[model samples]
Target: MKQIGNVYLIAAISIVGGGLFGFDISSMSAIISGDSYLCYFQQGPLNADGSCSGPHADVQGGITASMAGGSWLAALISGLLSDRFGRKKAIMIGSVIWVIGCIIVSASQDIAMLIVGRVINGFCVGICSAQVPVYISEIAPPTKRGRLVGAQQWAITWGILIMFYISYGCSYIKGPAAFRIPWALQMIPAILLFFGMMFLPESPRWLAAHDRWEECERVLILVHGKGDPDSPWVAREFREIKEWCEIERQAKAVTYLSLLSPKMINRTHIGLFTQIWSQLTGMNVMMYYITYVFTMAGLTGNTLLVSSSIQYVINVVMTVPALLYVDRIGRRPTLLVGAALMAIWLFANAGILATYGTNPGPGGVDGIPEASVSVTGAPSKAVIACSYLFVASYAPTWGPVSWIYPPELYPNHVRGKAVALATSGNWAFNFALGYFVPPAFVNIRWETYIIFGVFCVAMFFHVFFIFPETAGKPLEEVMEMFEDPNGIPYLGTPAWKTKNYYSATARMEHGEGLEKKMSMEASPERHEVVGAKEQV
Candidate 1:
């Protein structure tokens, strides 16, 4: 019980890295659409009384895309760095980077300075996003792995929720400080994450892979039980880990190139496409631009901020069910159901917008006509309802599942690299979406949700056809599922329906029943029993 308690504690702390990632996102999202932020960055003509106009669409897109571009570069390198220095150390480095970025952004005097600071923060977000899941998945027990790693997503949602409200509160302030205060507050979590990781145990699998067998044994004992180095659970787990490491040692040297080999290619594809599909779900469009979305839905001022806050509240609340039930009910069903529902809501939103959304005439700003009125009535309420529903569907499914699935696919030897590549893909796609969304809203108006709805439909099929069920299987056993020739066809099948299915931990108690039965038939005891019966 104590050992398990430690695992939860460590997970809770380490996942604050994820919280920082969420905080950066909400910090920017909450501020970018505000009038003060617009006035500060806006570069064109002033209003009749010489008041500043809001920023142009292109500028908003650039500011948002700049961070994603930095994340893209950092995510590509973070894997190699983590693989060399270790996951915990990489996370600490990322936290420090985040703090530095907060200071830079808070102190910025111009758009150039703000963009630079955001890019620096993006680098930190990329590192934490890639490493936190890998570290948590490495240490968590198989039965509890889903929720443990899923905790990262839980933290991210909490961060987003807290920052949205904080940004809302700050909106009441008089000047540029409104945004700066929220940006500065981000340092609190980053500082805590950096200091907190100092006392946590290193990933046992990573230790064993590096020939630190003694430390690995110690950690395994500490995490899996209390002071029992020779416990059956610990011994079996250690042996299997050592066996897998030896297999890698005897094979051709593991490298970034090795990820392309036939043995690993499928796993790599799964990781890469899962992230691609996740971004295609269009969750970030709502997250990063919720205020803008609400505005388009006919809300303004505090009404816009309050409506956006409700969207995030639903996001945080709905994600709880997934954290609790993903391990119990499994990954595939939650994702499939979520994807389907998301498609429904997005299309519904697009249809409502097409029917009821006003088309701006000439001299409109950011897709809204200068003469537009606040939308009231059933249609506007329906759009709000569908927007919340989209978030509710996503928070549990794609939001958390995308972060959890990739690390489970690869063996320890290449887990870091594989996850890194996948995370980079996520950021790369994120960059494109961030760059595309502001203009997409400006040019396409109500049809923007249609594009995402189509992507969601494609994602639903992609997951159903290609994604395997990894629930309840140990990391080692999950590797075998991919290695087995017969396993590929059955990848999508649930564990309960599959014949000869057993999790790695369960195998310890049950043994190899079929193999043991075959061995007993050839034994002398069986032959003598048959001879005695014939003589009698």
Candidate 2:
């Protein structure tokens, strides 16, 4: 077999993990409203006589909530597990869980069984979500890192598109087949990931951390071939790892509470808030509850389905531009533009509904009056157009960039815990919006969009004030940026000048000295791993 560049090959493995994120998300969307899923334990559709017979509403809610809750819990656990066990192992274990979950889902006999299956799938998704980005971020070169790590978002969009088509096709079929077919189909990707991962290389950063320098070197040689394994270039890599490790070892003992200590606090804050802002930006509300959103907007029947699908299709289409421009144009500017526009669109939607969304004369009695259908002073077409525009702007910027930011922000040592904390926050907020959006729309109507608008406005300020430009930098350098959070405004300064900006005394006080220690321990090991490969 022909050998490929280590960088490209690693990227492919990262994409496999990303694909699992997509598959889980897509499969759930397809099954959420399906009868077989609702009926697996007697939660079927209402009988022809319109009797209250099948699954109780509470049971259905439990099934759906269990799946989502499982993911929420998994996101929290995955971080610590990935940190301790290594990213590749976490991913492989996640893939195994994914296969198991799919099997459970396919064979589920009752509502309780189906809910349990979904929880397992959620666990898998959470694990992959936490580790995949870390693996990609660690393995990718500084120059291509943004684009490579950003592939997770691209994979998600592709999954969303595929699921949309799957649902579109399934809708044409009858009975249990519609949902069951899509759920069964997900096993293919799960199996592929299982086998694909078996052949993939481990993250070099991970190897360096575990005192396996030689493995790190061989992997680097494969990834960065045509160079001396012991060259100066390689020396820089070892130095960085050594420095990081030394710092970790000397940081006066890192406990879970230490994540909030002065040295690490900013990073913890960044990770926490990024995830918070990502969820609060209302993206999940649009993805998970768009059908209900549209239905409340006076859309119904097939039009509702098609309109919702168009939103998903737009989400899928916009990811291409997001991947292309995120690294080029940078994270802050993209999010700022998107968030500002989203706020305006949300307000406009609310305004239109408040002014003209009234259903006069008992359900409005169909096309009784064109004037009644018209939103006060606003064209219905215009309102709908603006809503779509909001989606387009969000998809290309805030949507994918949100996922890209957290993995890039934290240092390698704390990345897993930081990512876990951040993503768990994300899913928790997602659960809130998922549970609330439907009720919000029903009870408050236009006011629901207003709340989202408010959050977008808040996000605009948060991104501008705190987020760093992570594009085109090595993970080590990215972590270094956090050493002086106050210096983010001077990112364009030369490296030496930036180093000079931090007082040597302050660096030591803030645990820079400790980072140096942890990073070095792996250097000898890295050399051994690389050198051994040469001898072989």
Candidate 3:
């Protein structure tokens, strides 16, 4: 049977894995504030307002974080599986795991069971999150890589928005169905992803890594050349893949330690931190606990839920511009500007809540187990606005760039493992923050925003000085830039310039060293693609 080779269509379907991430975020966030979930789980002490508060902060945090914890563990191994089995198969495996997890969550009768379900669900998320971007990056052309990979983040935002509304509608349900129904519905996408993957081809780069050159070229032609074997763009891209594969074949097989090598260490650090800092940006914190943030701001019930929904809508909308233009806007400017904007909003939120928040005690508005400091009037609106602006800034910049940046940094040999490591960094901090925020809300209250605000500030300088500009450069030249003797590895070019803008034919015509006869129009039958300086 013929598999789907349209890159855009593949990206759209494969990103269901990303949508599962959105589902997980809103599944818990949307309902945690609702009484049905809190009372059914017996989280903390039940209140007259159906809101509970106190002693189970840790338990509540644990339950909320179990999925993250499971993702953390699953992400660690996802790379190995992706490498050994193939990207398509790895995604399918994660989908199966996701369905199982949702089933477990849907049926759970107690807290332990819920935790188990969430952890299982998290395991699926870990695998998908780590692999989805890697898979997309490998299949997509360099010029369009950012846009294709950004679809994963876009899918995630869509998932969050869709699931939040689903949970919000279910909020009126009288019993456990409020949360259970949403958790069960999570299965539908995972099942779709599992079957959808069956009709998609594996990554061309993955094929090359395993020495399947003909199939590799076919995939490249299919996805990049529109089935034209002699397409110039396809020819150039194929040769680059060939040359890079030849280089990677001589290197030691990738292991965790290989990432520490002098050549790879710079990219390893950069990739890992890019992901780590994404979590520290406090975006997920807002994602997981925005209801709490808005509650503290003064809205409750449908009012608060609808307010949070708008933020998710903003998240979905703001991401589109970046998705279309990131390659042209460049990764550095987006991250720099995004960090600056996020910092301003976080600080704004901190100031508003710090000055005006008051303890509302056990009443805690409505639908919550407990309430701490609360805000009302203009200050509450200001705090809510800050949350909206923060998501607006994050959705386009770090949200997509973080996932797009890391996977593109490495060659095929180490991409699976390296991206897995970097992604694991994301899951690790994501897990810690998941567990940390509930208590932070209790102990430090408004001050939590201050910490994230500080983090945003620190990351601005980090990206300014260290992160290399990768926009529009081919993967081969990116590796070459890192290996360039003139600059440090992480800082690929001496300056962030497009070093290889000329295509193979253009360079040949311009006499940039290659013989004119070595044109991209050379016979498609030639299988031995040699080095740039060598004869074809």
Candidate 4:
């Protein structure tokens, strides 16, 4: 039996898929606002400054948002593909699609062509978003899984930081080709992923679920070592996979709608809402539109450029702490703690805006309000500090752990479909956030913070109540824990309202009588142990 000790390296390698995701997202922000690309429009209702105004401007905004919109559509589809195919295969396909999209975008002559390219790129990203964490989690040992999977978030942040730097660099380029270079640069990593993944192994759990026993054993030997397939160590794992696959096969006709069935409803609800709360936390809006937020905060001078760079730095730095503590501190604590801190910072920011966000020059434009908004009340120093704090909080908590949790929670057989469903939900909310933020910022910036703040508060109960603590536990054990809806240990539930964790545990402990009641959910045995040791 071969014992793999440096699981982190394996996990980190898998998370390169996430770095690709970040680079794809951040690379565009610089080019999106560049003048050379926008100047190609000959028919322009020109502003006095020679920029397009009115309808032309609206068209440009849609074109820019379409990249994100394309990604949303891609996110929805990738989830299904990742589940139906293997995670590694889905990743390989995404890389290929990404290269194709980059080619289309770099060569685009018109708005329509660019939109098509962005849509393709978005789909590639969606697949990465759903599959990278799954790959990382499956490859990692349980004790190190959280930290390793969390590295995906770190890689993503690093990608964003690289994008910010690249954007800053390209801003100085004078021609259309200059802007196109940044967009073209995205193909490099996508190409690497395509070539690199061909050498990687399929997830053993994924193989086992598919009923490829011999292949599963080979992967196990390659990854963990030749162990007694029947030893207690491997037995639990083998048993769990067989059981899960059986449950999944029995529910063979289960469509996405069947997720609403009583047998599957709790998992569905958790899957949907977890993604919702993840986005409602305002992470993407903050990332995709940081410049707009800074400008709104009235930090529009050189300060705006500096602040954007600072956010990139903060995001990267925060990932270090998250990677260090995600497994150590536990998943729920990291997220809830980050959520609470995020709420407080947001409130402080909102207050800063309210107190000092007056339109420049004391007030009115004739009879109406003028552009009197200012960020004068809060010191520049304070604003900078708060920005870092917010970024740091999000980096460690919502940023990493959210990606880590879903794959661990779902049974391997349904992981692809379920994660696809969850990530698709994420993209849907992502689209809503992107589409709605302009209006929200225009009419009620402070109110938007309040709404996000409300989501932060709700996350506390959601984490403590519904979400499981997946640190130090194998995927099989975690799924078993969540299989029973009545197994949840949280507030406002019928079980906990009347009692506590001990009482809930007691009830579960004595539920052997009810075990038979769940017989219909049990899987048929199809595995047998051969001569192998328990550990490598």
**Model 2, runs deviating above 4 Å:** 1-6, 28-65, 226-232, 359-380, 485-536
Model-by-model lDDT, in order?
0.79, 0.66, 0.84, 0.66
Give the number of the best model, judged by lDDT: 3
Native-to-model Cα distance after best TM-score fit, residue 265 in candidate 1, in Å: 1.7
What is the Cα-based lDDT of residue 201 in candidate 4?
Answer: 74
Backbone collision count in every prediction?
A: 0, 30, 6, 15
Q: Per-prediction TM-score, please? A: 0.90, 0.81, 0.91, 0.82
Q: Please write out the lDDT profile of model 4 over residues 336-419, one tens digit for every residue.
A: 798899888777767776766655432211111111234543544455567678888899898888787777766666667677
lDDT of 1: 0.79
lDDT of 2 by residue, 1-536 (tens): 23344665666656766666566555655555444444444544544445323344344335544655777788878877887788878888888887888788877766667778888987887788777877877776654566677777777777776876787678667666777677777777767776776676777788877778888877666665434665544555667777677776655643457677766777677677777777777776667655545544566556766777787778778777877767767777787898999999888877877776765431121211111232423355556666687778788887777677788877667777778777777777766665665445444556777898999999888777766666655577666675544655423323223221122233234333335444435676445434423421
TM-score quality measure for candidate 4: 0.82
Could you list the CA RMSD of all candidates, in the order they appear? 6.5, 7.3, 4.2, 6.3
Question: Runs in model 4 with CA error above 4 Å?
Answer: 1-6, 37-61, 226-236, 246-248, 297-303, 360-372, 377-381, 483-536
- Candidate ranking under TM-score, highest first, comes to 3, 1, 4, 2
Candidate 1, position 128, lDDT: 88
Better of 1 and 3 by lDDT: 3
lDDT by residue for model 1 (155-216), tens? 98999989988988998898998999999999999999988888888888899889999988
lDDT computed for candidate 4: 0.66
- Give the range where candidate 4 is weakest over 10 consecutive residues by summed lDDT: 362-371
